[model samples]
Target: MATASLSAFTRGIGRYALVAALAAVFATFAALAPGFLSGANLVSVLVNNFALLAIVAVAMTFAVSAGGIDLSVGTAIDFASFAFVSLVLAGQPIPLAALGGLAGGALVGLFNAVLIAGIGISPFLATLGTLFVGRSVQQLLTNGGNPVYLPPAGVPEAFRFLGHGSVAGLPVPLLVAALVIAGAWLVLSRTRFGRVVLATGIQASVVRYSGIRLSRVTAATYVLVSAIAAIVGLILTSTVTVYIPSSGNAFLLNAIGATFIGTTFDPHGRPNVPGTVLGVLLLGIVANGLLLSGLNFYWQQVGTGLLIFSVLAIGFANRKAAARA
Candidate 1:
């Protein structure tokens, strides 16, 4: 009886480990960093550090929840940024350039979809190929990878607004991130198609037996993932006013880590929007706090890596204990 009770206790701790870790980290930062809890710093963490990663991580969640990983998410982001900047430089209107950006991202998705859904290639292999091809293309386009910067005088106020402007007292990027989170949550948790997607992820053979067109669903999912990732590309380009070749890859590792960290929120270990958001927040706080605590960039990454390892280790241990019990 005592052993059984201990197993239950262990499972409970494992289930809420991520949340507990987040709270502990927040308190640690608040105590250690002088301005860690300052309103301005909090706002900066949310808008600057958290928003873009949250978006990309959420995009990753879709692919993961569907039983796949998108190694090309960064590729999609780069394509969108490339297309957006190229069009803007060609004197295209902002909206047109934005559309072209989305199209660019969608094209990457479509390529992956064909390779995976049509040709029966595994998602991992398909996306890895996309990433390599995308990188080579970017290098060729930029003449061995130079950044394309918008002329300061030619930069549009509207473009800047997407990155830095506020709407109703909230940063625009934050607002966009919020919408993406909410929309993804609703789609994954509420809609019929979302249910089907989740179900498909669990067991494609079973879903296929139920007369669902697995290939169609998989194709749509890759496209959705890329489109969602493109939003980050737009915001990134706006914020930096430059398109740096392969720069979007910077978010890839963190996004993957954040999405997995978020799975700790679910009893069944499913990837979820809320979990992803919290994961992003935890990393964001850790990053900002470490910087303020005088840690260099490399050390900050080590800190983030350690934090992720700890949380996931706890969660996995608990899962094992629960199984033994």
Candidate 2:
């Protein structure tokens, strides 16, 4: 009886620990970092720092929750950026350019789906191979990975609006991130497809036995994940007006880290949209605050790593104690 009660208590801690950590981190920065809570600085964090990572992390949540990891998510982002910039520079309409970008990302997902679902390759190996091939393609296209920049005079106003313009005093990127989060939450928690995704992750054989097409689910999962990633590519290209090959790799580790950090919030250790958002916010705060505090880039990484480790370690210790009780 005591063991069961302890186990329940530990589970509760595991679920809420990430939330507590986020609050505590926010408070610490607000107190110690000058102007940390200023409205403009906060907005910068949300739009400039948090937006891209949030989108990619949300993309990763679907993949992870479906029992797969997409190392090629950055590949999607890079290809989309390349396509968007190429078309925009070629004088294509903004809408068409955006579609081209999305299509580029979808192509990466299709390739992965083909390998993983059609040919029965492991997700890790399949996506990793995709990442390598993507790098080679980008290098070949740009004279060894040279960036493609859109002429400032040639960029359309509508294209700029997606990255820099405001609607109702909110950054466009933030609004987009919010919409993605909401959509992801709805799909994960409120739809039949969501249940299938969750069940597929937990037990693929059971999902198959229930008459669900596991291959289709896996394919859809990767496609949607890559499509969402491509949107980030478009936003990034708009913001910078340039497409830097392999630049999306910057968000790769953090997306994976944020997604896993989020899993700590689920008592069952499942990946979730809300938890992933919170995790992204926490990392964003840490990054912004550390920069304000004049920490070197390497030290900022160390700080982030320590915070992630500490949070997971504490939760793990609690669970271990409960098990022993």
Candidate 3:
């Protein structure tokens, strides 16, 4: 078999290999910790990750599906959260401040789109630049300090409801995550824009040659990603009631790792919403399980990084095998 053919087969199989690896990891953790899958802990994991991981996973799906990546998403969300909470604490109405913050995210997306698609810069490099810019902006705004606390006065219980309240005994975060997943799935599965993204990701020039405007699709994707990130920021700050400039740091690595697993089952090389959601759940479970197992917080980070690397390696192997066949 030719080298290129063999590589492609490997990539194809690497996808499923990731699935098995994810399952195996869960099994090992369960065996090592008796209460790893208890009803309470299970719910805990879902509730914690539902906002951050699930939101970014769904957005990463859109970004990656469009044949692009946004390294800045994590920090960008932080900026949005800080800007938003600061406004609320300063007595600004929630709607006005939130809309402005969400718009700010869209602007960040627009910046990324311009750099990557319009200027023909590499998406990785472009987003890396924005990642720093976004983080720096948050730091600059906060001036090397934590943001002021946002008291819940005048904030609608229903608005905070998305983060804290539950429906049918299930946390609102889960419901929101589900809704985001369903929305993403619908866009990818049922829309012309979705088809455009797939085409662009595989070969933008080819689609462009067919007279389609690929840049628009690509640019729009960054906007969508940033918007989603802001939405997550909103829920997160509400849940915590304070804005930490570095709050979204964990999402940077966790999101990429989970995002990859999501793509295996989806059309756009994205974290299939369900796969990404499950991946988020798995990450939450891993951390919670380790903590419950008496592992140090430091060990949790180490184990998580290693787990992500291992899963990526398995995904690589699967993709390679499938390519060769």
Q: Local error of candidate 3 at 94, Å?
A: 3.0
**lDDT tens digits, residues 1-325, model 3?**
1122544434454545555766876788788877877988777767774456888877887777777788888766776777777677676777777776677667778899899879989889999998878777777777765575766676666457656888899887777777888888788767999888867877888989989887888888888888887777777877877788767766767777677765553322344556676666667767777777888889888987787677667665655555555
lDDT of each: 0.89, 0.88, 0.73
- TM-score of predicted structure 3: 0.86
Model 2 spans with C-alpha error above 4 angstroms: 1-11, 319-325
- Model 1 reaches what TM-score against the true structure? 0.95
lDDT score for residue 168 of model 3: 91
Q: For candidate 2, write residues 1-325 as lDDT tens digits.
A: 1123555545658656777888888898888889999999999899877989999999999999999899999999999999999998888999999999999998999999999889989889999999999999999999999999888987889999889988998889999999999899899888999889889889899999999999999999999989999999999999999999999888888999898888777666678887788889989999999887777889998999999898778667655665676
Instruction: Arrange candidates by lDDT, descending.
Output: 1, 2, 3
TM of each candidate vs. truth: 0.95, 0.94, 0.86
The residue-by-residue lDDT of candidate 1 on 152-255, one tens digit each, is: 88998877887888999999999999999999989998898788888978888998999989999999999999999999999899888999998888989999
Best by TM-score: 1
Q: Is candidate 1 or candidate 3 better by TM-score?
A: 1
